[model samples]
Target: MSNPLFKKINIFLKVNEQTIDSYFNANDPAPIYKRQLSQEFEEYIMNYAPSIKRYSTVTYKLNCVNESDKEYLDPLVHAIRRHFSLKKSIREAEFKKFKKRNWVLLTFSLIVVMFFQGVMPLIFNVEHRIHSAFSNALDVFSWVILWKPIEKLIFYWNPFLKEISIFDKLINAPIIIVGEKKEVAPMEQEYAA
Candidate 1:
């Protein structure tokens, strides 16, 4: 029998690889790539716990909220959906391309974001706040540097919690309390016959 833990890790990696490829394919080299990368990072977190999947789905649902305002929301939804769909098209050709120079691609992305968010602002005399550029660089760097460690922690923490039930109790106690509580209403319910 296959270990469930290993099965989950495999799924997590597969989904992330798909999400990355989708974002990479977009021809326009805008600041949005950084956002997409950050999003994929969150998706990696959700792969382990099924309950947390709602958070990711809610993000997609937000795209559908203003359907009548197609002029604004349509492009945003198309871009998001296109990036996600590319994950499904992964194959030997794409894997080979990705394997050869994943680091190079990451570095190029950082350079593009820095140039636009950093140098371009100066060149164009745009007086945007410094926080915009700094935040973008920081986010990209954090995601790249932190991805592996975060994955390992999420993968192992579940089993570790199972082994040490004490930690589990501590973490789960609040959830249990909230689940058991009843709130009293100011007004009593009245039924008319």
Candidate 2:
């Protein structure tokens, strides 16, 4: 029977054994076994050039081939299986990391919101005095503006809170712009050249 690897190479499958080896050595040694399997498959493809027929999705079979080649192809088949398994593990780990980061950010943003909500009434009464509908509205607006900096500070200090909601971001925009303005000092009359 022909080696499947050899046929894959002929069709430009683009599997780099050396690169695979390097990656396996540097991070994960498991794929090395699969790389060896791939090489063996390539050898079989070169020798027999087996007539391959796709049986199903991700499954293939050799037609009109000798049974003798099966012994040599076993390792190659095992290697392919191992490679896929390792690839799946890597992907799962990455997804978990992404989820962890997202969760942390979300928790932090919620905490900031809670903190703001708790302090709002006290701070508003102190700053504005005599709470009324207008004062309450103004205080809420001021709190919205300050939320960004407060959220950022909390994130920086805690490192655990990172998730910020769209509402929180929108509330911060106007305040951020307002915060950027510098007070104009009393100007002495100076003629521009």
Candidate 3:
């Protein structure tokens, strides 16, 4: 038996002038490190998204046919890191907003429920027939009003955190460049976590 944490997951990228353009938006005039990744390239990367695990040793392996092609390595890696880092930041903001919204909703619902149960009783005497009916109705209404936010708070948050985690992993994953003569370029200092 082997520890799953030791498993290696490699995402391979062929780096060169011709293929580099295909990785980014063709219409974008920005430099490679600033350009948005193309839809096809994003989709290709996402195909491996589900396989990533918290302890998985994920890496990006860049293969360059010529030594000249290796010049593009730093820019390409920077682009990838920038893309996923932005995604993680956006997801974190969204998660924060989600938590705040749900908390507000739950608080509002509790206040409304309390008013219905507390103040409404004073309007109708306890012995009145309509009192019981209104009380039961208020209980049902409170449950209905609170259901959505409670459900969201309990069950819906895992996906947001999951996406953020995935983006973080992608942003920090090690990148290795392999050249034609089987030479391994030392990891650039800027790319190191």
Candidate 4:
């Protein structure tokens, strides 16, 4: 029987997680993705894309890759490409949304913190007990309000960035669609073992 048009895709994986499971079950991507991402990131990507099955060592086949029909292969590739593009756009949108929140939070926090630090003391004339109490309250409140934005900007941004990077890589991944699997000779098989 003749083989399909594309086969033997050798994926040069850059997202080196600790184990194969981590790579496949990209729930959190940490400490691979670490503090940069969440389990939701994995869902966001996988929700639209099908799972890739491994064909051999360091090689994976897309859906219906073993089929000899050229038409079957093309649709899978197109679907995969479309999904990658769609997911990348989603991530970009999410990143922009988070960035906007960070800016807004930062701006509001600056305003409130200034009011507490600069105006509160003046309002209480700096020497009163009320002044000290307000100062302490302001310090604590500022930390609370600003904490999320700080975390989002400093710690949470990396994973989305990494996801985008991975998506880009997959989108541009070198796809080698081989004809079919070749039978191995006894000598080569023994050597491989």
Candidate 5:
């Protein structure tokens, strides 16, 4: 029986002279470590993407039939790291942009609300019946104007942070190489790009 607390999610890849190229985009002229992953390969990995959670662990299980095939392991791991590292960086940038945009919108909405609540009141004498009616309308309008930005600030950021966390885990996940006859090679440490 396996320990329930130590859950592992394995993404299996067959590493060899023939299949290695299939993992990457053939059109990319860059080196192996910098090349973009193929769409099919990415889809294969994304099948396990949603299963990653706060307590779950991800591992790349590479199957190498020949001794020479083991040489491709480092480059493959490096490419995976680089790809997800780039993804994480891009997500961080988008998250920053999201925060900045929402703050700006909230600030602008507050300014508008202030103008309606403060400046508009002086335009009409407070004792007049029209002034009392307009005051109530403006109060409701202020809340309506401020609703979207406040809602976005409160709720919309969770998904971005969650995706960034997933990418971070993928970038630093461990790698395990397995050979024929059920023999396991030594695990490699995190590959930093």
Candidate 6:
């Protein structure tokens, strides 16, 4: 079913072609492609929310209301607000936790890198031990050791930022608080008596 109220709204974003294609291909870009891909879902909501309220007894209105000026009537609106608030909290928490985890991994990788850079020369004759197995291993290991830092630096933060942004939009979105109207039935003569 289609909702006409939001038919003209355009929330679609322009991004890389590969990113656009990935969304349709059922590819799992997850954290990496989150920011661009999430726009589609947001667009979907922009179109659907009006229809949802139009059909249900629940309705929503957008306006500036001070804390003291508001009246609460519907439980459904409260539930919806609570759900989005919880989502916002989870998004914030995930961002903090993921950033901390990335920092920890980066620090460990830095230690491994520093051991090779500063201490290795003093403790082991790396240049003189050329062609030895341990020397070769060190040569290979140094490059391999950089992977975590590279990954954490380049790709790790995208998911948290994108997800948090999505949650923020959702939590702040104005929504229907309650019933659209109350129908009053006319009294019959017998009932009027």
Who wins the lDDT comparison? 3
What would the per-residue lDDT of candidate 3 be over residues 43-134, giving only the tens digit for each residue?
98878788876667678999999988988898888888898898899999999999999999999999999999889989999999999999
Q: List the candidates ranked by lDDT, beginning with the highest.
A: 3, 5, 4, 6, 2, 1
**Model 5: per-residue lDDT, tens digit, 1-193?**
6556447788889999999999999999998877899988878887887787767798888999999998888888988888888888999999999999999999999999998899999999988999989999998999898999899999999999888888887888888888876544445333321
The predicted structure with the larger lDDT, 1 or 5, is 5
Tell me the tens digit of each residue's lDDT in model 4 across 1-193: 4233222334432221222233333453433212222244346444423222222112324322234444444433454465667779999999999899898988898788877777767767767777777788889998988888787789888877866765765576555555445799999999999
User: Which candidate wins on TM-score?
Assistant: 5
| lDDT tens digits, residue span 1-193, model 1 | 5444432121212112223444333554664433343455435433444432211211222212222333333333344444444442343335445444555555666676566556654654335666567566666765775555445444634443332332222122221001122455555333321
Candidate 6 lDDT over 77-177, as tens digits, reads: 34335555677788788778877877887788778877876666666664565536665576678778878767876887876665555545544555632
- Which ten residues in a row are the worst by lDDT in model 5? 184-193
Score candidate 6 by lDDT: 0.50
- C-alpha RMSD by candidate, in order: 22.7, 28.8, 8.6, 13.4, 8.7, 15.8
Looking at model 1, residue 18 earns an lDDT score of: 28
How much is the lDDT of residue 169 in candidate 6? 52
Each model's TM-score? 0.21, 0.39, 0.87, 0.59, 0.88, 0.50
- How well does candidate 2 match the true structure in TM-score terms? 0.39
- Order candidates by TM-score, high to low: 5, 3, 4, 6, 2, 1
List runs of model 5 lying over 4 Å from the truth: 1-6, 182-193
Which lDDT tens digits does candidate 2 get at residues 59-112? 223221234433333343345445444544554565567566656756676666
lDDT of each: 0.39, 0.40, 0.88, 0.57, 0.87, 0.50
Q: Give the higher-lDDT candidate: 3 or 4.
A: 3
Off by over 4 Å in 2: 1-57, 62-64, 126-193
Q: Least lDDT summed over 10 consecutive residues: which range in candidate 2?
A: 170-179
Query: Between 1 and 6, whose TM-score is larger?
Result: 6
Q: Clashes per prediction?
A: 1, 13, 0, 6, 0, 2
